[model samples]
Target chain A: MAFKAGVITFPGSNCDRDMAVALEAVSGEKAIRIWHGDADLPDGLDFIALPGGFSYGDYLRSGAMAANSPIMRAVVAAADRGVPVLGVCNGFQVLTESGLLPGALMRNAGQTFVCRTVPLSVENASSLFTQSFAQGETVRVPVAHHDGNYFADEATLDTLEGEGRVAFRYAEPVNGSRRDIAGILSENGRVLGMMPHPERAIAPAAHPSLGGEDGKRLFESVIGSLVSA
Target chain B: MKVRILVRLKPGVLDPQGRAVHHSLEGMGFDGVDDVRIGRMIEMDVADDTTDEALNTMCEKLLANMVIEDFAIEKLDNEKAPA
Candidate 1:
């Protein structure tokens, strides 16, 4: 069976094409492009991808406006139905804003935009998203965002940690996120949200300035999980 | 009714922008600035019949992200506040 993935494109989404390309490269299937305005997603989607970008011009708050867009209602419903979803950067913000995930992405503690490849540890290898990586293995991926600092109350943070919902942790402090969290998975492990753009790092030659193909495994993991399921 | 919603980062949450501004103030020879925190104020015009429940729902749903921020809602009477 061919993998069916859909990539959502909000008005200010700049990385939709890259996400589509990455999906195609990994799954060998063309990604369906969905606009933010449409109220419904295509029937029977195996996976959904929300790419990083300054949706709605980062108005009100990063990803806040886009989270309330018409299409998000469908996205939220689809996620609840166990469709795997991946949110990157701004898309991660949307997941938090939409209540699909916990915690919020605040402005970087450095108070400046951070754009560089950083080392991340695979904290949980049990989830569909991180199964490709061995537990505690470190990988380098690029992160580019101003509001990528993850914040949650101490109790919630503790709960997430105890439940092993933390999917990735920064090997080094790239942003002042609580507990150095770089990525997280939903309770069911069907949804994954992270600030780093794995799609941008999938191709080894894609970013020679920041060399690595560590991101390819992320896409492959999702594809493999769907195929096996 | 004119409703004002003040959304602020919860206490104990790090406020980098606020800290940066505080540093700038200290650089300008200001003293006794114990700390600084930044928040947002959103004012809205709603019908007089708008119930407190509705306002609270709005805050919980959109005006504030409960994870990192807290919100306070204030309603001004028509006589003194702008519609």
Candidate 2:
């Protein structure tokens, strides 16, 4: 069976195309593009990707407006139904704002937009998104955002840590994120949110300086999981 | 009814923007600035019959992210005409 995936495109979403292309390149199936205004998602989707961008012009709050859009309601419903969801960059903000994930992405402690590839340590390689990587293995991925500092109460943070939900942590302080968390997974590990743009790092030809193939394992992991399931 | 909602980051959460503002104040020779924190205020007009529960729901749902911020709601009385 062909792997089915959907990538949501909110207004001002610049990385939606890249996400779609990356999905197609990995899964050998064209990804369905869904709009923010759509109230329903296509049937039988194996995965959903929320691409990075300044959705709704970052109004009110980063990803706050987009989280309440019609498609997000469907996305939330689909997530609850056990479909794997991947949120990158601004999409990570949306997942937090939508309450699918814990914590909030505050302005970077440096109070500036950071755009570059950074080293990330795979903290939980057992999760669906990081299954291809070995625990504690370092990979370089591109991150571009102003509000990627993750904040949650100490209790919640402790809970997340205890549950082994932290999927990735930065090797160096890149965005003032709590405990240098670069990515996290939901309780059931079906949803993953990260500030790094794995889609941007999937093709070596696109980012030769970054030696851009390390991120392909993430997409491959999701595809592999879906195929096996 | 006039409703004012104040949203603020919880204590212990890092406030980089607030820290920058504090540094600017210090650069301007302002002293005794123990600390600084930034927050947002939202004002809205609603029907007089709106219940407190409704206002709380709004804050919990969208106006405030319970994870890192707290919200306080204040109801302001309308001005009365002089007799």
Candidate 3:
């Protein structure tokens, strides 16, 4: 069968179309658009993506409200079953809020919303999302948010690093994430939550600042891994 | 019954928003302030017979993120909505 991918759109999510378009561009298949209120995901889905945006106007906290919505329960179950899940920006907040990932994204230590392409290193190139990347290679991706500073206790950070679960790390300081972490993977490396927007960088642009196609490799990696599996 | 839940960033977690406000206070010439931390207060009205477990569940499940936050539940003695 054609690659089965789903992109979920929480209310106020602006990156849903970009995510779907990127998925289709890389996978040669239309990504199923799933709504936040829907309780069930389409079955046999090989991949699921939660795109970035200010869901519920970022009420309570970034991704706090949407994490409790009905659709997330289904998403959680899917992740538990070993389906690869990718969350970006606010979606990263949602993943942490939903308990699918650890730690919390707090307000930026710079006390401002940072929006630009920043360099990130592939901390773990073996995960489903980063397999296309060479270990420790620098990649540029766009990040736009006020609450991307990642925070967790020291012990959890040690555990994540020791297990090689950190999928990406800031090559240069962008947000004040602990240990300069940019993205992380679940225990089994089936789930990834990152503050950077790979979907925004998949297509090459006239301006180098607009990002090249490094982000496409991530989706390509996901598609390639799933197809072979 | 009326309940109040106070959610705070757990100790040692950075609070940039609170720090910004502290800077503003300093800029305004307020002195001797050692630090500033911010917390959220959520008030709810529920059935009189609501159980403690249910209230705690609400906080644990949605009201607060346990990773970097802690919450305390307070039951109001009487009607204490704003005057």
RMSD of each candidate?
1.6, 2.3, 1.1
* lDDT per residue as tens, model 1, A1-229: 8899999999999999999999999899999999999999999899999999999899878998899899999999999999999999999999999999999999999998999999999999989998899999999999999999999888989999999999999999988999999999999999999999999888666546775778989998999989888
lDDT, candidate 2, A41-115, per-residue tens: 999999999999999899878998899999999999999999999999999999999999999999999999999
The superposed Cα distance between candidate 1 and the true structure at residue A113, in angstroms, equals 0.3
Error in Å for residue A119 of model 2 = 0.3
The stretch of ten residues in a row with the least summed lDDT in candidate 2 chain A is: A202-211
Q: lDDT tens string, model 3, A1-229? A: 5899999998999999999999999989999999999999998999999999999999899999999999999999999999999999989999999999999998889988999999999999998898999998999998999999999889999999999999999898887999999999999899999999999888888986896898899999999999988
- Candidate 1 stretches with Cα past 4 Å from truth are A206-208
- Once fitted onto the true fold, the runs of candidate 3 whose alpha carbons sit more than 4 angstroms away are none
- Candidate 2's error at B45, in angstroms? 2.4
Cα error, residue A126 of model 2, in Å, equals: 1.6
- Per-candidate interface DockQ score: 0.80, 0.74, 0.88
- Model 2 stretches astray by more than 4 angstroms: A206-211, B80-83
Error of 1 at A94 (Å): 0.6
Q: What does the lDDT read for residue A215 in candidate 2? A: 86
- Among all candidates shown, the one with the greatest lDDT: 1
Q: Could you tell me every candidate's TM-score relative to the true structure?
A: 0.95, 0.95, 0.97
Q: What Cα-based lDDT does every candidate model obtain?
A: 0.93, 0.91, 0.92
Instruction: Give the Cα-based TM-score of candidate 2 against the true structure.
Output: 0.95
Pairwise TM-score winner, candidates 2 and 3: 3
